[model samples]
Target chain A: MAERTNSKKHYRDNFTGWLLNIPYLAYTAVFFLIPLVWAVWLSTMDWNLMSPDRTFVGIRNFTGMFANPKIIAAFFNSFRYLAPIVVLCFLFGLLLALLISNLPDRIKGVTAVLFFIPYLTSGVATSVVIRFFFSYNSAFNHFLRERFDKDISWFQNPTSAFWIIIAIIVWKMSGYYALFLLSAIESIEPEVNEAAAIDGCVGFRRLVYITLPMILPTITTVIVLASGLAFGIYTEPYLLTGGGPNNATTTWLLEIYNTSFTNFRSGEGAAMAIANAVQIFVTIQLFTFVMNKLNRKFGV
Target chain B: MKRSSKIKTGILIAITAVLLVFSLFPLFYMVIQSLMPWDQVDKSMVLSHPTMKSYQYLLGSGNSSDAFMWVRSLLNSLIVSVPTAVVSVLVGLCVGYSVTKLHFRGKKIIYESLLFQMFFPGVILLVPRYILIKPLANHYLGMILPLCISTWAIFMYINYFTTLPNELFEAAKIDGLGEFGIILKIAMPMTKSVTTIVFLSMFMARWNELMWDMLVAPDIKMQTLNVLISTQFRTMGNFPGPMYAASVLLTLPIIIMFLCASKHFKEGISFMLK
Candidate 1:
């Protein structure tokens, strides 16, 4: 009788817990899980919004994407953006974090807020402002022409367009990443610093040997975070270049948007999106693996 | 040695000053350029002749062509983001509260699923989500539904609730406080900081969101400021003032929020470090 009563109490507790979770659970089912399954099913059928009939295409959409040039460009451009973003963001964030950490406490708070402003600015807003700056009759272009006898259409050229996107992303993200590194830097024990100082470790030597090793895990996290962010690069490229100048900056998200929505090839778009998802999963795993190896090797 | 330390501090300050110029110059330029007349914009570094024509235009006092639906979209932004932030927090708080405090069979699975969703690429569901939301297009339901739950918000609450001592809840139970009553009175009161952080971030995320907003709401009457800015920017090249003004307007609320609650904003960012 005692055991049965205890089991009943446990069941009641479980029921209450589930009842409390009903909102999130029901929401995930309708919005997330249902769409997820539908996405997989849609990948096997050729369909569009206007059409009432759907034709089953089997795996043709998946296979065709591998051979498509736009798909191929999208695949490669992700890596093209990923490497520089990780490197530049890491370097710039480290510099800012180190500089800000050295400041007095009052100024430090003010400066961190000031630096974080760009991250808060919407990509659309920033891109609009940047577009105006680089317009043909703008002061920037006029200065380029008069000073250096160069009047370049910034967005028309593929290489300049690519570099412009990278510059914007780096500008936007570096400070946010700095906040992460700043917290990590601040948390380092003063005892550790004092001991290193007593042993004559200071300045650049201390940074390289002592500080760098201590902050490796955060560094790893930041790099992985930045790398994952590269896959989601849509706003700038979509607004500025339209994946143009010989498809130089065509990102996976851009291609997916165009193929699915613009062209109404939902089946093919689903296939590409699935592939993008798999690639993201694999790349993150690879990055985590590499970072883990580095962490272990660095004696962290 | 004291002199060297002072010199180091001076050097650091100088470097920071230089970097600040680079970081802040674009925003400064935007504000300045927005103040210029259409003809004078992007022509000079200094705003010799400032006007409110751009801001006026964005507010629908300019030529009809230039006054295409900016303020309405701003309202739409508010309508969508506020509800999204509120609903996301409530759901996250409840789920977070239950997961941490209650005994459940599938709590571990739910947590694991949330973690997977956090790492999941959101782009993969675009096609299917569009199809599902197609019937509800031009409706606020289509715009706000998908974004009403975030894995990050749930995690934030979960992590915060975990830190509170279990004995407090036990004590409340001993005092005949029901589970819901304890959550409402005790748990909610203690989690004000975490709630603020989650709510602010969620609001910001939904406000800044463009693609999903654009996709779901193809109706011009229902578009957010971001979508309006993006679509108008393509053709508004010659008249640059309104574009700058619109961008400024889009960013203003966020800037204000950050300035007001910078400590909480920084705390939110630090949560990611954990």
Candidate 2:
């Protein structure tokens, strides 16, 4: 009986790890791995989401993504959203981080939450309020006209419409990003600041020369985040603009949705999605590669 | 030097205040817009004649089926979000403890893959995940399943689990309480920080879920609060006050939850990052 029990104990110990890991393995394989494979598979087919034409077309759908006009426009527009938002968010986020760092620690939490409220709030709702705020007939523009004799129709004009999107992104996101930057700033040893001060660093000059380089890694993370945010920006554009003003606000994801759902081109939509993933993967890798070199060069 | 430092302090305070107002203005405007009576919700937006008419309209005392969508969406959100949170946390805890504690084959591979998965943007999976799950669209489970796992959360829980004292595990072993019991009794109870972190972040992500929710639950009755509000913004563009009220309603629960649980969340989140 003792020998039988001993052998059973050995079997249980050996298999216990597998037993415990069963749930994660099963869930991840079914949900994540399988879906990933299915997406790639579906992208190669010409099926319009259901029934009849279930033919595989190799890379035709992939090539066709670039050929499509709306897809091309969306490709450029993602950059338009990505560049300005990333740049301005870094600037504003850094400033907010610096300012927040100066506040007494006791009240910092309250202030951070207040600022992060927008970030936490639904992007869809904020965009709705913003759309109303910038509406041509609203008091904001009316006041602008009354004060400066200028009544710019924000939504009707593509340039202004794009900027309004940028404003909404920066307003809602910068503070949240600033919290990450704040922690980075707080991590800097005070002695370094004193050392820089002794070497004549002060104010804006000090911030540019001394502080910016120190937080480059955190800034890299922020850039990655902001860019990811730009790509995933569906709610605001879909709800606020509906990719309107002559498709000026249409994004990659929006185009994909339009093609697959509205246009009944699921295969093409999946292809567009694959192409988007590749671009995001490449850019993120590039950011990481460049940031790593910069980190080394900047002696961090 | 003292004078210059004082000036710097003033400048910092000024900047902080300005940014605070800019950051907070939309939410403030939303509240004001929701409360302002229709008559005074004019071009100027001066709060001369404030009223709760919009909220009234929102609650559907106006008899226009307005409240039905909002209430239904909120309930749908609760149905989906609650399950997603509970499911993800349970999975995270199980996987985290198993990978950290038990001696398993392919353990290193599992750990590394989760790390690798973390680096990829979750949105990249959005399209594919949607396509695979599209048939089950409109069902609550369809929306919730795609968001049920987070590799990052798993790793976070693993990191937390590894930091736990090994003595408890040994004691549990000596007592012959078994691996599951050790994890359930000692490892789990002790890692409340990570639990709160995992639960809150998952809850928030699931709550604010829009993309998948939209794709999977586009049917009017199945839409989430966020999706419903977004659709409201699109369909009811003319009714700014009532829409703003809806926006406020959607945002208020999160704000209140954050306020109540923020002390826990701040530490939890910061630890996750570290």
Candidate 3:
């Protein structure tokens, strides 16, 4: 009787284990692994959206992408968009977090909720509002015209448009990032701050030398996240300017989309996508390595 | 002696005021534009007399075409978002439970891979996914399925699930409950807060998804709310009032949802970060 019961229990255990994992395995296999493999195969072929023919052209698409100046320019432009947003968002977010952390609990909660509003709203809606705000007869330009007699064509002029995008990116991200910082800051024991205060580390000095170092891991995570976000900045630029003023705001992803759908070069698009993937992978790996080294140096 | 402190407080307050204005001005402008009488908007005028004409056009009777399309897109968004949220959370729960509780081989590798996938920008997979799915499913199901199993959701689930005490599972196992039964009866009930957070985040992402819908469902009849908003912007050209009106209309549901979910959002981010 005992032996029969043991066998039945073991059989049930095995069956339940398999059943528990079945959905997950099926999902990852169908969605992630299959699409990933298909991307690899598609990258090696001369496939277009309309054409049924997919002639394999090993590594040529990658080489062509590398040789193209436009691709390189788009790559540089992505960096330009990324660097300012990441740095500005982090700095401003930390500052806001420090300010909010000092406030009363209810106010801090309310402020955090207010800041997170923009992050929750659709990026398309935000971009649309921004697009009009920068338009010639819009309120922003109207304000400029009335105040300074300066009617800058915000979208038409590349430099002005670039700065506007930078401003929008920073404004949209700072609040979201600030919430992360606030939570991280809140987790730091109050006694630590009190001890610092006892040690004559008050005001900005305390924030700079104590609080900042304490949240270094969270900061690293935020920076890594911001860098990842920078690479996928398609919808805002796409909606606001349609990669316009002569493709000045065309990002790497935008370029990929244009190459694949608009221009009917699926093979090249796949190659660009792979190139982008490799770039992001290497960038993230390098950042993680650097962060690990920094963590060791700081003994965090 | 205390004057400097007062001065610093004043400066901080001033700075905060400026930040608040900068952050909220675009939304304020959107509201103003939405309320402005369409005929009063002109090149010379920036702010015009407020009117309910735009809102009336959007929601009023006898304006069936615009209202109908808006309602259709809204329904479509709910359809995609609700299912995506439920499925993603359930799948994530199972995956997370396995990684946290089960002593399975290669679990570490799967966990790490899921983490990496979460941090990786999903744009790289967009083209390939479009190409692959265009032939197989070819509709809303195609887009929703690919998006439903987000790396973020899975990572969040794993992180939340790891924090759960393993004693509950052990007790259930001792009680002769199967693994699946333990998860269904014990694990899920214990992690309701985390489940709610996961659902909200996944739903928000799906609700706001535009790129995939645009890529997969080019038909206007099949478009999501985000796509509908984009289409309005593209076709409306320079008409700021109606555009703003439409934007405001589309944003209301999300704003309401966010207000309800803000607490969950905070808890979720804190839990994940921890």
Candidate 4:
């Protein structure tokens, strides 16, 4: 009787737990899991978004994506944006973080909030202002033409426009990543820093040797986070340049948007989105591998 | 030595000052541009002329249809955000409570599956999620439902719940409370701060959300603020000043929220960082 009662109680416990988990289960099924499966199925079909009849095309959508030059260029542009963004976000984020945290106590809180305010604001707002700042007749460019005899068309030229996107991303991301990495930086013991200083470790040398290796994990985190964010960069390219100058700034997400919604080719868009995702996954894994090796080599 | 250290501090402060300007210039420029006359935005003397005409126009001084659309979209944003915030937190709380505190079969599998959703590239589901939820596109359900489940918030709750002492739950159980009662009586009240962090995080993300909002809420009558602002920007050629005004209008509520509850906002970011 005792053993039977014990088993019954255990069964009741399991039931209670599952009952609580039902909401998440049902939600994930409807939104995430089901959609994920449906996304794969949709990729295999030929259908406009509005049509009920979807012909089973079976990988033609995937094959067709490879033939498109704009799609290919968008991928290349993503990497182009990703490379500079990764480097610049690390450089500026780390340096600014070090600078801000090292400030006098009273000023530190005020400055952190001020620096972080940009991160809190929506991407659309900032992109609009940036677009204006780089417009043809803006005062800054006009000043450049008048005084320095230097005027590069930001939006009109592909290379210059690409750099503008890179600059905006770096400007927005660096401070945000700085705050992200700050917690890790704070956890490092002050004694280690004091000992490093006693060993004549200061300035850039100290940062490169002592700080960089010690915070390798956080650095990895920052890089991964920045890179992942780079993949989903729709707001900037869409709002700022309209993926323009002959699709020079069009990213993976932008191309997918165009292929699916703009062209009403939902099947092909799904295929492209999947292909883009796989590439991003592979890229992130490679990045993580290299970082891990570096972390180990640095003896962190 | 003291003088040199002071100089070093001064230099650091100067660097900080420069960074602050770099960080805030877009915002400052937006504010300045919003005040400038519409025709002068791209002109040489951009800042010389300042007027509230852009703001007045956006505020519907003449009650223009375009301005009226913007006002409606702002309402649409609030409508989308409030429910999303509530749903995300509650669902996260449920999952967090189930996995961490409750005893169940396949609980580990459930936990892992929930987390696995995070790594799946969000890019892949854009089209499919749209199609599946497309029927609701004309309704608010399409706009809100698909965007509500945040793995970040879910995991944050799970991590937080682990830190709570088990004795409270055991004591509540001994007092003849059912699992739901215990969760409601103890877990819900105790996890107030975590709930705030999750709710605000979801709220902000949903509020600023554009891609899905644009996709689902395609009806011009029911677009969100971001969709409205960006659509205006794309279609309306050469009206940069009013666009700047709209951008300011879009960002102002978030800025106000940031000032009010920056702690919760930073906490949410830190949770993601972790």
Candidate 5:
């Protein structure tokens, strides 16, 4: 009788937990799981928004993406934007974190919050303001004209325009990433730093050797997250240039948008989406492998 | 050494000054341009005299074309955001609590699936999600429901819920509370901070959402602030003063939201970084 009662209680607990989870499970199935499955199925077919019929073409949709020149260019353009933004943001963020960590506590908190303000602003609204700043007759060009007696067309030139996007990204991301680095840095025990200081390790050398190695894990996390974010570079480029001037700033996501909505090529758009997904998955796997190797090599 | 310290302070001050100016200039420019007399603005003068003409125009002064559409867009944004936050958080809390406390078949698989959704780029879902929701077009349900289940929100809740001691639920169970009651009364209240974080994050994301909003609601009547800003920018040549004015107007809410939640926002970003 006692054993039977114990088993009954355990059964009741399990059932209660299962019952509580019903709402979330239902929601996940409806919104996320169902949609993900649909995405997979849609990838192999050509289906329009209002159409009832979807034609399956086997692996042709995935293979056909390579034949499109715009897709290839967009894939490359994505990296161009990604590399500079990720590297510069990480470097600048680390430097800022170190500077702030060395400051008094009250001042550090205030400055950290101040720096993070831009990251919280809507990217679309900020991009609008940036667009104006780079306009042909805008302040940047006017300042250039007055100072150097030259007119620089920022949006018209691919190289300059690309850098402008990078500037916008770094400006938006630096402070946010800095806050992360600051938290990780603050969590480090003070004794290690004090030991280094006693051994006459101060300034940049101390930071390069002592502080960096301790926070390598956080750095790796930031790099991975930033790289993942780079693949979905839509809002800034879309709002700033609308992938304009011969699609110079057109990243992969923008290309997907144009293909799906603008040109109404559903199959081609799905193909692009699938291709981008594969690339991202491969990139992340490669990044994880490299980071693991580096971590092991450094014993971090 | 003291002299060098003074020099260091001076350099710090200089850097701060430059950064502050760099940070505030674009916003100041947008605000000033919005206030400039339309005629003087076109003349390319720096620091032109301010006027309320642009604001008056956007608020439906003489010769305004469907200026009330901005108000409609704002309403649409709220409609989408409020529902998205409420439903997403509640669902996340339920799922989070279940995964942590419940012993069920395929629980690990379900948990991993949710995390997998987080790393997947949202843009890839555009065409497929559009097709999925196309069957229920022109309704508020169609716009809000598909965007409600964020993988990040669920993951955050799960992480938070796991940290909660299981003893709390066991005590509640001893008091004759059902599973749903424990989740509602005990689990939800204990996780308030994370809940707040989730709600604000979802709200902000939904409010400023662009790509999905553009894909799902192309109609002007259903556009959000981001889409409105985009449309205004795209047609700036036709209506420069009003575009700047609308940009300022649209950005004001987000700026206010940021200032209020700046602390939590930092924590949230740091959490993602980790």
Candidate 6:
């Protein structure tokens, strides 16, 4: 009787478990699994889905991506954006986190929430505001011209346009990243800081030798996340620069978007996208490996 | 040493103050500019003549473009995002509870697949997802269906569920509660914080989304506020005030959510990062 009841309960558990998971299982199968399979197949075909005639031109699209200048530019742009973003966001985020962590408890939450507001703001809205701020005849430009006797085109020059997009994204995201680092910093035991202070490790010495190493794992997370964000940047550049000033700011997403939709080269677009996915996977894995190595080397 | 430490503290406070200004000035300028009369926008920093005409224009009280349907798009955004977040969180809760609490076959496989799904960027799936959902274009189902199952939410719930004590569930079970009963009566109540976190974050994500929303719904009637702002901002150069007003509308819902539950919001974000 006991064994029979146990078997019955097992059966019931299995039944309910699978039943509860059916929705997500079905969703994943349809949206993620099927599309993934279809993307692989489509990457090899030289025809769009809407077209009646389908032709498979095996591996041609993959090899062809390397020769495309836009693809090359995109590949380089990811790193170009990634390096500065990682460094700047790390510095700014660490600073914000450290500063906020030390604030009086009464206003700490307020300041932290205020900093996070930009993260919640839509990319499109912020882009619009920035564009208007820098547009010709705007008060900002008028101020610059009147005071400095200089006129700077915000989005026309490639280097400036690149930095502008970078600056905007950093400003929006650093606050969000700071929250992660702040939580990590707050988790440190009070005893550790007391010991460090007794050892003359106050101020910069304490931050570097004590707090930094302890939160190195979270810093790794922030770096990897910042790098990932670099690849996915589309809306800001699309709105503000249109990936222009010689395609300097064209990201993997923007390029894939223009390719698949505007140019109707779905096959090549799929190839580029697959390349992008591989790039993200490899890059993140590489960062993880390097960060782990550094974590150990730092003796944390 | 004491004087130097005071100077250092002062410097840190000064830096924090400057950072706060940098963080907030854009939003402040946008809101102030939005209040300016249409002709005064971008002409000066000062709101010498503050007016409600921009808000009125968006709300159909004045001459506004037929293409910029603020009311209709706002409704569409709420309709799509609210249900998406709710359904996604509820389903994630169920799946998470099942995977963690219930004895099952092949649960590992399902969990592994979710982990795998995270590594593949959504860009790769764009073309095929577009092809698949093109039939459902301009429909709310197209917008919501693909986003209704979030792996991240499921993972979060799973992590939270594991931390829940099994003894409590066993006691509930002994009291004649079945699986769904225990889940509804105990698990759901117990995980309220996680549920709130998941729902709020998912809602914010869907609300802020642009790329997929723009792709699936090109029609004017079905556009979200985000899509409307992105597409209309470039063309509305003559009436920048209305654009700023729309931007404010875009940000208002999220700011309210943050104000209401910032502690939970911050905790949720930090938990997800971990």
What's the lDDT for residue B185 in model 4? Answer: 86
RMSD of 4: 2.9
Candidate 5 residue pairs in backbone clash: none
- Residues B1-274 of candidate 4 have per-residue lDDT tens digits of 4998889899999989998997888888888888887777756444886799887777788446555876788889999999999998888888888888776788988888976888879888888888888779868988888887788888888998888887778799899998778778888888776887788768889988989988888888888888888887766657787788888888878777766776655555555556
Question: Taking the tens digit of each residue's C-alpha lDDT, what string does model 6 give over A1-300?
Answer: 454668756545778889999999999989998999999999998875568888889999999988899899999999999999999999999999999988766777788888888888889889879999999889999999999998999899899899999999899999989988998898899999999989999889999899999999999989998999988999999999888888899999999998898888899889899999999889999999999998998736
Best by DockQ: 1
Per-residue alpha-carbon lDDT of candidate 2 for residues A1-300, written as tens digits (9 for 90 to 100): 554657544334447777766777777787778767777887888877668769889999988876777888888888888899899998888878888888767767777777877777888778878888888778888888989999788788888777888888898888889888988888889999999899889778878777788888898889888888888777777877777787788898888888887787777877888888787888778878888888888736
Task: Tell me the spans in candidate 1 whose CA falls farther than 4 Å from its real position.
Answer: A1-12, B65-68, B265-272
Local lDDT at B223 for model 3: 85
Give every prediction's interface RMSD: 1.5, 2.7, 3.0, 2.2, 3.0, 1.7
Q: Tell me the deviation in Å of residue B32 in model 3.
A: 2.3
Candidate ranking under DockQ, highest first, comes to: 1, 6, 4, 2, 5, 3
Candidate 5's DockQ: 0.49
Tens-place lDDT per residue, model 1, B27-112, is 99989988997888998879988999999988888758646588889999999999999998888888888888776688898888
Model 3 agreement with the true structure over A82-155: per-residue lDDT tens digits: 78878998998888887777665556777777776777677877877888767777656777899999978888
In model 5 chain A, where is the ten-residue run with the lowest total lDDT? A8-17
Better of 1 and 3 by TM-score: 1
Worst 10 residues of 2 chain B by lDDT: B39-48
DockQ score for model 6:
0.69
CA lDDT of each prediction against the hidden true structure: 0.88, 0.79, 0.77, 0.82, 0.76, 0.88
> Candidate 1 vs candidate 5: which has greater DockQ?
1
Of 2 and 5, which scores higher on DockQ? 2
In terms of docking quality, how is candidate 2 classified?
medium
Candidate 5, B127-162: lDDT as tens digits: 877877776665677788877877788888888777
Q: Stretches of candidate 4 above 4 Å error?
A: A1-12, B42-50, B175-178, B263-274
| Displacement of the residue A72 alpha carbon in candidate 1, Å | 0.7
